[model samples]
Target chain A: MKKVIVHVTLKEGVLDPQGQTIETSLHSLGFTEVEEVRTGKTIELLLDNHDNVEARVQDMCTKLLANPVIEDYRVNVEEAVQS
Target chain B: MKKVIVHVTLKEGVLDPQGQTIETSLHSLGFTEVEEVRTGKTIELLLDNHDNVEARVQDMCTKLLANPVIEDYRVNVEEAVQS
Candidate 1:
């Protein structure tokens, strides 16, 4: 099977309240060296073999997994591996 | 500054309803070759320079970003880069 890992993160100018909260909490916990914290999501897909897998997975990201207006996604494909 | 990428994925056998929903949606959208889909979170932390960064971030993951009993987290530390 083919496994694809997608990393989805918010755009540069977007406000990430959750991240900010985490930052403050981190400082409170004594790790005060934080500059910024951005939170995002990772999606792993196990697929039946297909042609043009990367392009197809990117299509899925563009269409459903990410919001193009506010987020950008990176795709990492783990070629067919023994499972 | 340093950037740490934390990938948090559910332990095997944990029920992932959101991932299941996404898999179904993908098939409906004409990409029916999917076998399984797992969803998780990625936390990007832009941190101030400090010693033992990886250990600190892993601590952050176990304490806040991930549920230790149900999730496994991987940490990637990007050494200070000119930014």
Candidate 2:
């Protein structure tokens, strides 16, 4: 099996209210050293063995997993050990 | 500076409706080889240099970034290269 990990993060310069909230909350919680925080999505998929897995996974990210206009996504494909 | 990455994922056996929906959607999009899907959060933080950075990041995860009851979190700390 193939294990694919897609990280979808907001593009730089985009406003991230959720991240701002988290940063403020962290400071209030006594983590004062925190300068910035950004939150994103991690999508993991288990797939049957197939050719062009990375390309196909990228297609999935573009088609559904990520918003290309406001987000950037990175795809990493790994071979899952047989159990 | 320090860069910390916290990956918060649902524990095994926890029902992930969102993942299921994504999997179904991928299949409908013709990526039928996808067998399973899981979703999680990727939190990236920038922090001023401090003592025991990993421990502090772990504390942040426990107190805010992750729900210890149903989620597992992993932290990776890296030294930010001076630019």
Stretches > 4 Å off in candidate 1: none
- Residue-level lDDT tens digits of model 2 in A48-73: 98888999998998899999999999
User: What's model 2's TM-score?
Assistant: 0.96
For lDDT, the strongest prediction is 2
Name the regions of candidate 2 deviating beyond 4 angstroms: B81-83
| Candidate of highest DockQ | 2
Model 1 CAPRI rating = high
State the lDDT of candidate 2 residue by residue for B1-83, as single tens digits.
88999999999999999999999999999999999999999999999988899999999998999999899999999778452
Clashing pairs in 2: none
lDDT of 1 by residue, B1-83 (tens): 89998888999999999999999999999999888999999788998888889988988887787899999999999767665
DockQ of each: 0.84, 0.91
